[model samples]
Target: MATNQQLTTIKCLILDHFITFNELSSIISYTPDLRRLHFSHRHERDTTIGSMSSIGLTNLTYLSLRIFSLNFHDFEIFIGKIQSKLITLSVNISPNDITYLDAYRWERLILQHLSQLERFSFQYPDSVDNEHRYFEGLNQFCSPFWIKRQWIFDVKIVDEGIVYVIHPYKKRCMSSIALTNLTYLSLRIFSLNFHDFEIFIGKIHSKLITLSVNISSNDITYLDAYRWERLILQHLPQLERFSFQYLDHVDNEHRYFEGLNQFCSPFWIKRRWIFDVKIVDEGIVYVVHPYK
Candidate 1:
């Protein structure tokens, strides 16, 4: 139960250990004007925890769920009960003892339900192939009956698809899901393979003016000239800035710098004052007009 009713008017609720999703959902049901709700819970021994009815959060604009113990079937049952008026949804699935998704199951279970979703942030711990659900979700968003055509705001993809999409995988399936209205994008991929960069650039060629990438030290060595050309310079015709960080102390400082000179375009990178590609002891981070 909530501690005070006065806080209810506050509109945002974040619950950690003590609160159950069922109780939290009910509390939000009472607060019609609530805008944000974030909750994390592990699957206890009992399967019956949260509600299956629409939460009636008609005023909700943001929702974050860090579900730990949730199983595949439980996810299906709970999502229907979890309704949101949200324009942004951030979900992190850190599975414990269960494997809930394959490619097909991901399409049917998660993406099918998020009809009105716009801005999205997602993180996953295991294999990245499941992260294709973003595109799957985007498909539903673009469906004539779902959200309006030009509604999404930002798309942030985190460490989940590093292996499959950013590593060795050549064709990022999500690249085809058109984000006609996206303004801001933040990506931190873990894979060293340059092919993922191809998929990243291929998917977001037109709508992106601002881009951020976090390349870890482990994956930094594999970055090569051709990959940089294909992913960063060629695809982003409208790119105004380029910011990059090297994750590892690879022996190719001369090679990488030469590649940056040869392949990188000053027409766009120089024009965008925010573009920066520098090395740091910890790792490399490139930020491009992060605001928009």
Candidate 2:
């Protein structure tokens, strides 16, 4: 339908149907004022045409891609052909597309083309069988560029595999992607406070079954089992298995307490998540583990 006339004042395009790179070019070429494009691309739609012509979308500041069966190499070619100073980019790559997690390629691509980008979100659902192989690749996201931006690679455990998610330190994690399938989750996020966590936890669907979190805290409220009990009981009703290790540093200014023996409440008893504490070299470790 868009093959005939030039769209003059179009500002955004959400095309769930994508045929090929050339088709995308042709569509965007018609919409000269396009500022955003959200599209889905699968292998079936990846048809080869003649040489791809260079096209500039100078006003296109936002781009989102839901990749179903496309390889990272093909995605790179598609990105290279589009000239846009993207301010925000979000991508959801399907399971087994590990190449999209290559932070080096992203660094190069952003620096070369999307240098003006500010917000970046990436999600990859991968198999838990290959979990060990992914830890090393995680270091690539820890480079200085990401550190300055306070971007952390978060691995959320699900039923089939882990979902690798990255977003700004204090922003919503995976706001665009629905994690209703998330069941078992074990995560260590040092940059979140109770408010941040409350905002995050409230967003997850009630399908989470098991949760294990490790936190190093400067805020004493993180040690308040009563607060956690109230929050989780109110929000995460389906959560049965629970484990946590909270590190209260030795040099904390607001004071430190290792004797908060309030974990034996009805909630802890029901979940069988017994709590204990230990003195590490740097801090006191308060732990909660399920019955073996």
Q: Please, what is the TM-score per model?
A: 0.42, 0.58
What lDDT does model 2 reach?
0.80
Regions more than 4 Å wrong, model 2 = 1-5, 129-132, 171-292
Q: After superposition, how far is residue 240 of candidate 1 from its true place, in Å?
A: 25
User: lDDT tens string, model 2, 262-289?
Assistant: 7878878888888888999987788888
lDDT of 2 at 170: 81
> In model 1, which runs have C-alpha deviations exceeding 4 angstroms?
1-8, 49-52, 97-100, 127-292
Whole-model lDDT, candidate 1? 0.54
Candidate 1 clash figure, as a count: 3
Best candidate according to TM-score? 2
lDDT of each: 0.54, 0.80
In candidate 1, which residue pairs clash? 217-247, 243-286, 245-284
